[model samples]
Target: MADFNLSLFDTSPFFLTGIPGLESAHIWISIPFSMFYIISLLGNFTILFVVSKEQTLHKPMYMLLCMLALTDIGLPTSVVPKALCIFWFNLTSITVGGCLTQMFFLYIFSGMQSAILMAMAFDRYVAICNPLRYTTILTNARIAKLALVGLLRALLIVLPMPLLLSRHPFCANRIIPNTYCNHIGITKISCVDTTVNRMYALVAVLVFVGIDLTIIAGSYILIIRALFRISSKQTHQKALNTCTAHIFVMLMFYPPFVFSTLTYRFGQGIAPQIHIMLANFYFVAPPMLNPIIYGVKTKEIRDKVFKYSCRM
Candidate 1:
């Protein structure tokens, strides 16, 4: 029996906890998660479809928005369905390869989202700070180039993570206490030292996400200065109003992200279920809210959505 157990350790699937301490209530928990997933899918897809079909929407801001929509779609889709399966169908076991695949997509989309948000902030910066040069600086070709660079950066950064993780043999324990596979969670179950994995994860967040947030803050500072310099109150109000949606979306994303990361690293006294729930929220809330915020706040998008719906 001991030998059999040893043999199984190397080949066994990792079991997901799916909100620990609330196993009995997984059915109830899945209801809200499912609803959020559906809303995110519909909202982001609508944005993509509308943006692609309308020629008037082909500008730097809208292009960046479409990139955002793509990340929103990819981010949740990479994890939510698997989580729903765990919650609803008891399909909690995932192979090592499958878990790594899930982690790769999850991190890649997250990285891309951060880069795109920074790009959007720059778009607003150019539009407000140097309105005359906005068109010349952010042409269609330039927007495409920006999108490509963001994708490549995310790909290069995240591609190494899964490769690094795959080298470690996960034999002793195969149970992950979260609904989805993440780098840290997987590393915790490994038999050997995972200092390299943990350090790389920390470096990636500190370098990539840290830099993105700093640039975004700087852009907003310049934007505010430019807004105050405007002589016309109406123009100032209009410009500020244009930025409200992006700010709100950023708020939805970064706060929960920071909380989740900090809690995971330092909040050892916190309840496992609470940490799990907040982490799930970090993955889901931004995608679900971004399109709705943009739709209601951006007049062109709101109008296009209304017209498209009316025709449908």
Candidate 2:
């Protein structure tokens, strides 16, 4: 029994968690989560498909856009399958090794997505604010380098999470009370104390996602400042049009995330359910709404989607 690998994939015996106090909330939660998961899968995939099939979108901005679409697809793909099983099929059992593996991929997509978003913001900043050198600034080599940086940074930062998670020993009552296996919940099951894991989580967040988000914010500020300096109406209009999607996406992407961090870090024990719910939303909402928001707000992606759909 001690040598058993209790992973969901290994032994699909356990259900993730049943409803705590209110059974009705189970239906409410499961229904919406299922809807969100399906939509996100479809939306992100559609964007990727259209962007890939179209020849006109071969430029740097479109390349970055497609990369974002890919990340969004991968982020939820890592989460939703396990979540669906846990939520609906009653298959929640996961081994310590499996949980650590899941967390590694989870962190990879999260970190990679953050890095890609930062790169896209820089692309926009250069395209609109410095068109005189935009071609040279984001040349083919530079774009490839940015993509390499995102993957490498993600690889480097996320490796520690699984390594750290593996070192912890799980106890008998390993029924993690969440729809998916996240670090906070997984760490809670460890017989060994989880201070080190939490510290590692904080460090990874700081170095990868946190710093990238801060840099993204600063990039946008500079962009806005540049917007103010431009005297011509057309330039202002073009800048505003290009940036509006990014600004809204940033607003959607950042504020909930910040509050979510405080909630998960500080409120976990006191309000585990609420914190867990918020953490679930952190992945679901961003990946789900990103394509929709960007497509609706930007004409290019919207037109491309329409064109591809018509052809299909």
Candidate 3:
């Protein structure tokens, strides 16, 4: 229509203005970001390595942990390097195609992480609620299917984003006010109507992440109820103990996500700096903390980590 006639997007580069209000401190900011990246990479890798190599850890729970580790690694990898380039080297010009690519994988990994957490909740539910049927119910084939479905679900849901945005005519203003490219951040610069883009993103979050969180909540509620009915206090304590790591991880994962999403939509009172910082932390905290949470709260991972470390 008139929108397309007025503006057309060329294959030019999109400039990223790293952290809206923190440009003056980008060098200093890169220091902490670098440290987080290293810690997250190392920590998630260690978890993946320990889980894969340790024969004792070859169960449904540990398999799910490995999936979490992979997702943890994936999301950071998608954004951090480009962010570091922007922060440290002042290389902020990313092609439209490249920006969209990062946006796609960033969302995909994030969605998968949420799905993996839901699967982990299911793993715990079966383990605690139906102990005898755990193995029979969650066979290797089923676990594989769950993982595949999670990956595909994320891919399918996020697939329309870049394609939808690509058709839009972008104005001359290509500066994305964040550390890296994001769906809303990128789409906001377009001269054309991005109502579809915004609505789709909202629906995707509500349908995908919303449903995953609801399932996780329902599983935990059932878990708590089952724990309460157990006759033996020791047995109840043990069951609760097993879920502590996952609970810690879930706490670390969901809060920042929810807060960032709220800030993007309804938080007009919040400062741009704070909102941008929260978005950055949403990508950083989960990956960095998940392995540590598992290692500290779960004895087996702790012992295995140390066992491998001592030998090396």
Could you tell me the TM-score of candidate 3? Answer: 0.95
* Residue-level lDDT for 295 in candidate 3: 90
Q: Encode model 2's per-residue lDDT on 264-288: one tens digit a residue.
A: 6776465667666777766778778
**Can you tell me which runs of candidate 1 are displaced by over 4 Å?**
1-10
Candidate 2 overall Cα lDDT vs. reference?
0.74
Which candidate number would show the highest lDDT if scored against the true structure?
1
Clashes of 1: 0
Residue pairs in steric clash, candidate 2? 6-95, 7-95, 16-92
Tens-place lDDT per residue, model 1, 1-312, is: 333223223556888889999999999988888898899989999999999999999988998999999999999889899999999899999887788889999988988889988999999999899899999999989989988998899889888888877777775668899999988898888787899989988888887779999999999999999998999999999899988999998988888777887788889999999989888867777898999999999999999999999997
Where is the poorest 10-residue window by lDDT in model 1?
Answer: 1-10
lDDT of 3 by residue, 1-312 (tens): 443322225767889888877888999987877888899999999998998898888888888989999999999899999989988888999988888889999989989999999999999999999999999999877998999999899989999888788777787888888878888788789887888899999999888778999999999999998998899999998999899989888888888787788788789798888898778867877789899888998899999999999997
RMSD of 2: 3.3
Q: List residue ranges in candidate 2 displaced over 4 A.
A: 1-15, 18-24, 268-270
